[model samples]
Target: MTNASDAAGDEKTKTANEKAMAGSETDTTSPASPTVRTEHEDDLDDAFKYLHDHSNAESTSIDLAALRRKIDWRIVPIMFVCYVLQFVDKVVINYAAVMGINKDLALTKNNFTNVGSAFFIAYLIAEVPTGESTSSHGANKVLTHILQDISSRNFHLESGWALTCLSGESVAQRPQEQPTITLFSPHYYTKSEQAPRFAIWYSGLGFGQIIGGLISFAFQHVTNKHFKSWQAMFVFVGIATSLVGMATFFILPDSPMKAKWLSEPEKAALLKYVSINQTGIQNKNFKMRQALEVLADPQLWLLTICTICISVSSGVITTYSATLIQSFGFTPKRTALLNMPSGLVSIAAALIVGFGVRKSESRWAWLVLCCIPGMIGGGLMSFMPASNRAGLLAGIYLVNAITGTLTVIYQWTMANVSGHTKRSVAAALIAGSFSIGNIIGPQTFQARDAPRYYPANIAVMSTQAGGAVVAIVLFGYYVWANNQKDKRQAVEEGLSSSAGNEKILWENLTDKENPNFRYVY
Candidate 1:
């Protein structure tokens, strides 16, 4: 009986090795298309290397649903906390404006608006380098979290406008942190499963809004002589943010392959399932070709423009909503409370569109649907009389619906782009465009237009409409590109549009280079 059992185990090991070897050969030069190799052997994905070495491992039965749940529980909460703290740290300045930071710091004229703009300026400059750093350094997401922790520590040091300027610099590191957060879902989930997961984490922005408001409101009651309420709020949020950052460093896995809790077989199985994305698991090679392709990729440009347009409204909401409410004859404490409802609006919109995309698979449609309410809200804010405080306040809440479009945009970029270098560059471009819009958003609100910034409100309305139009154009472009690829494949290879093999999926090819890749709208 012992001899028989050993023989059976040996046979199983032999069969597993054979299967792994066969899988590894799929990406090699094929007889049908013999002109060139899809990728150099050195450029193969990290998952490819893992599978090659683990060839003799026995195949274990895995419940994909259970595995997914396990991954979600372990990683999603960490991501959620990181996002919440980042936003709260950044927007705490908005709350502080009402808490008398401007008066206490002796900021006059456009000094307040400049402070808001300064954050995005730093954010824009840091975007590309951060993306490059993540890609070149083995795509480790934890590095950014550590950087965030270091930046958060500075929040406790400065006083006066110096405190606010340091806040801008600290939060500017967020652009570095965000792409990694958004990039995490695509690694584990398929196109269909990604929307809701993205929403789950991105909703941290809304939670930050609510929690920031409560923090500001609570701190306003502080009666200390040496430290003001705003100063205390900074210290409290800074300490909390640093703690969460430390937790992220220890808890979050850089990628599925790096996840310590998953067994070797489980990791292989997960990688195989997500291979359908036609976007390989992490590749560290920085291809100059892929980097150059970004400059000319129409999809990248369109996505960047759309992000910029929608983010204009986000800037308005993040920096000035409290100031707007206070301008409506409310006290500082009441203004903070009033801002809390907008958080609910943001959360509701994110959940609605997230589940909507998952159910209907119409990302573009959901994006346009979100923009409509935002445009309506912009109109209301622009036209409603200030005496009608309730009406204008309703407008402010409705504007938050546009925030959902950002969640869609984030998922869309990850799902549609392929190749590690191209994806990284694209993420940076989209993020930088966001900073550009934010810069523009605050500049539109000159002190000259005190109570009612008509120009800024109109800019919000116009940009929302523009974003919807561009989203439609982007959808049309994807459809046309897919058709063109199909025609070329039929003529050159005598293959149908769906004629893709596992080999093509593992190759580190860009969406343009990979004939198998189909863009997800």
Candidate 2:
């Protein structure tokens, strides 16, 4: 009496149920036992397929600690170098401004500010398409490495004394993939471990700041008649970045499943271990429903607003810090030297928050803590007399504390969001929001408000405060959502909320759809 499609569906479901029962009955400690298949094989995450084909009971006995270490050593360094190069490439112009880029380009009025803003505008435009492509394809190492190579080449070409605004626009379009690198860790880490891992790579921002300063200082001494100091610095960094890109292409794996260094048993064990995240390893299916859900999701909006608010301060720090430092009457050489300490402050803040989140699991508290220093710094910058160069410099360094907050936010999105399609969209939206704030950030520094730039300083203080409040709201929302899920599960099952939770881990459900999935603030 049933139709062909219904008969086929029933057969598939029956087979899946049989496989599940068989898997459950097998010896848990036996290395040779076949992988367990879930009841909803077609709808479940791609990780389920990997487990069915490659994993065994041996995964239960593998030494997870040793495996984690091996994975870390292989991948983390490549991630760190990529981040350092990305930030350095983007911020080189900030140093160039001090090293006579403005005079060389004959820029006047708000032209420099426009150049800064142009990059983010391009970033914002590229974000959605980039996310779609990464989701449709995979966020594999090969795709990312190719983007890095292209970015390096773009920087190299731009260094050839192209028109300032045009060069900024061209270079801005390429670094969109850099944030996508953060997407790689969820495949390799659990929710508890991702914060520190993310911090390790994100700290490259600090290193980039330090290295950019040194590079600028070193190149400022260049006396070549044919090449300006900024141009030489760009060319040198571009070559170095291209080489790193080449290295990454060869060294990095697409995913834990594809890692050549790991034995098959090791790969299986690692996959089994990270499955607790409930956020699948990879799923190429681009569900339109999932993408549409991102538009209505309250979490996405709140996180977007928070990202924008915090990134405003980030924008100010990234593009204008050198110019601000130089405005205090320091020479270009001294300005470059002074900028080095800000990097140290950034590094310290990132390490503190990274470890703090790992130990305390209080991401909301750390986020607020970061904002406090930024607020203090902004107040000093806004109100302090121009004569107090030392106080202003201290304020500049303290503002770098907020950079750590972005790292926390990055890990938050990965830990909390699930359903590969939804996660991809959320990541892109959050990154695009960052670009929005950065776009707003440079424009705040109008030419009329030069030197002290009171309005720009006040904007930083306000945005930091706003970000803190939104983070608290987001924390509360997660708690409320978790409570609702617990209540619903208790009522439906007449038992504990966690009953039969493991079966749903690989079901490829979004945070909203998964009753067992708990959000971490």
lDDT of 2 at 352: 81
| Cα lDDT for residue 250, candidate 2 | 74
- Model 1, runs deviating above 4 Å: 1-39, 138-161, 494-500
**For candidate 1, lDDT tens digit of each residue in 1-521?**
11222222224223433443344344322334331244565787877666555654443466666777788788778777877888887788899899988887887888888888888988898886766777765434444454455346444534456755674666556787778777778788777677777887888889999999999999999978678888889878877877776666667777888889998877877776677677777887888899899999999899999999999998898899999999999999999999999988888888788777776678999999999999999999999998999999998999999879999999999999999888888888888898999988888889999889999899889999999999999999999999998888778775443333445566689999987677877
Between which residue pairs do clashes occur in model 1?
none
- In the range 1-521, model 2's lDDT, one tens digit per residue, is 11222123224223433343333324233334333343455676665666666535356556766777788888888888888888887888789899887887787888888878887887788776766677565555534554455455333223223544454455544544654687888888776677777888888999999999999999999988668788888878877777887787677776777789988778777766666677887777778888888898888899999999999988898889999999999999999989989888888888788767766678988998999999999999999999999999999998999878988898888898888888888888888899889889888899999989999999999999999999999989989988887898778874343333344667678988877677887
TM-scores of all predicted structures: 0.91, 0.90
Off by over 4 Å in 2: 1-40, 141-175, 494-503
Q: What RMSD, rounded to one decimal, does every model reach?
A: 7.2, 8.5
Which number leads on lDDT? Answer: 1
Give candidate 1's error at residue 258 in angstroms.
1.2
